[model samples]
Target: MFKKPIQKYTGKIGEVEIGTGEKAVKLGGESVLPFYSFDGNTGNTPKIGMEISDVYPEGWTNTLKELYKDVSNDTVKWAQFVEKKYSPDFICLRLVSADPNGKDSSPEDCAEKVKAVVEAIKTPLLVAGTGNHEKDAKLFEKIAQAAEGHNVLLMSAVEDNYKTVAAAGVLAYNNKVVAESSVDINLAKQINILINQLGIGNENVVDNVGCSAGGYGYEYVISTLDRVKLAALTQNDKTLQIPIISPVSSETWKSKESVEPEEEAPEWGNQEDRGISMEVAAAAGVLASGSNAIILRHPKSVEVMRSFISELLG
Candidate 1:
């Protein structure tokens, strides 16, 4: 009988700590590919973060609306609900109100909301700005200041708008920053390098490879993630070895297969199940591709993915 060969690598993913004292959560520090414990050490199991929005999720699907209906009107209450009910590893606060096209809320207001949520949650928090680059720079600066010393993860400093967020990470607080790049490994590396150049240590950086839902170029994201991980471990690429985070909920729920009702696509079967499955599939793909943390929505999806991670790590 032939024995399977075990592969070892020269580099390990850097570990990042969020929160402080007893509430802290440590992610990354894995020495091998996801779930490849037979080959090398899998230093930490992936962590799940539940998403909460600064503004009411008015445009969310009915299912999502129902899930948070009781607390939808209040961001602090919503964060508390997720922490108490689901016990997620962290709470991700999406500052949708800061969107330039949307409420365009003032930086001070957004910062106050961030501070309130930070004070309300015991688990670590991940704060994200609305997708407006120019506005996010100002938004994150205020948020980073409000969340100082709390050790939150402030996402993200992209290729074009890194200086502002990176400076906030260094000057405002010791929080980590997410470096996002379109689905290209080299671009991902470049952004990480640029973020580090701003004096943010590699350990304080997380990579986001521009996530895509299952049917919408998800495979491309997965392949890019795989290549990045390969570069980190196989070739010992320091610039590529930081932890990766996937905003699975945001990507999956936006897909037509997830949000479209069964009435629109009868062949898709139950709409609720379809949406949950879509999230689970996307999350599992990212986890297997070496993501250390995932931002998720839907309690059912969180439950299912938690079980899946347990099985993989076991």
Candidate 2:
């Protein structure tokens, strides 16, 4: 008889609950590599958060745009549509309109939009800002205040700028913050520690150690995330023990494999199908490497990944 090798982990990813009432979602707390229930507790299945922007998506391919044509004009309507149509585990509202170089939308405007979305949808919300550090700080403060008591997952608090957003999300609003870092594991750990030092418990923090799509440095992301998970499970590193969030949709769509049209490259097959495949491939990689929650864009990609997750868990 042959013996099966079994491994044990000292640390487990912590669980953090978002939203309130029946539609609430819980992420993380997995004791094994995503769906590996035979070795340890799976805790909860990973959650998929559909990404919807506060502003109409600009520069999105026509295929991506058409998917939300009905509600693209309005942020609240878009959130409601995704929840009603797909019933995603959560909804991520990216406040792109707040970008200083873009719409430069006021904090009050962003706050109002956040409030409207929360009221319009039953799903838990993950609110994110444009990648502008200073602008995000201001945006998060208002978003946190507007979403007070809602327990939305605030998108980020980075190494260069975390105080304002961390305070807004953790201290002021009692919400959670996503501690983001580049592909560097040390930077990822450092940011988490910095956020925790601000009195935000590790339980209230999730890590986003950067995400890359297929054919776009995807392997680097996978390895970095795997390292983080290893440190958490094997070394019992507290700073890296929090659940991870990968915004795969954003990176996937940016890849040439996703955006290049068939006319541009006939060998790529249908652009839409290629894009979906790219997103699915990137998402699968992220999940396998230990992502507790993922933000996805296309509806078809979401459906496919959901089914894939079902099969994996089963």
> 162-263, model 2: which lDDT tens digit per residue?
999999888988988999999879999999888888888888998899999755477788999899998988888988989899998888887888889889
Residue 108 alpha-carbon offset, candidate 2, angstroms:
1.3
CA lDDT for candidate 2: 0.89
What local lDDT score does residue 276 receive in model 1, on the 0 to 100 scale?
A: 88
**How far off is residue 187 in model 2, in Å?**
0.7
Encode model 1's per-residue lDDT on 1-314: one tens digit a residue: 99999997999999988887786888899989889988988987899999989878986788889999999899999999999999999999998888888888999999999899889889899998887888888888888899998988888888667899878875557788888889899999999888888777887888888888875588899999899999999999999989999999998888888888888899889988888888899999999998999998989999999999999888
Cα error of candidate 2 at position 12, Å: 1.1
Model 1 spans with C-alpha error above 4 angstroms = none
RMSD of 1: 1.2
Question: Model 1, residue 297: what's the lDDT?
Answer: 90
Model 1 TM-score (2 dp): 0.97
lDDT of 1 at 130: 83
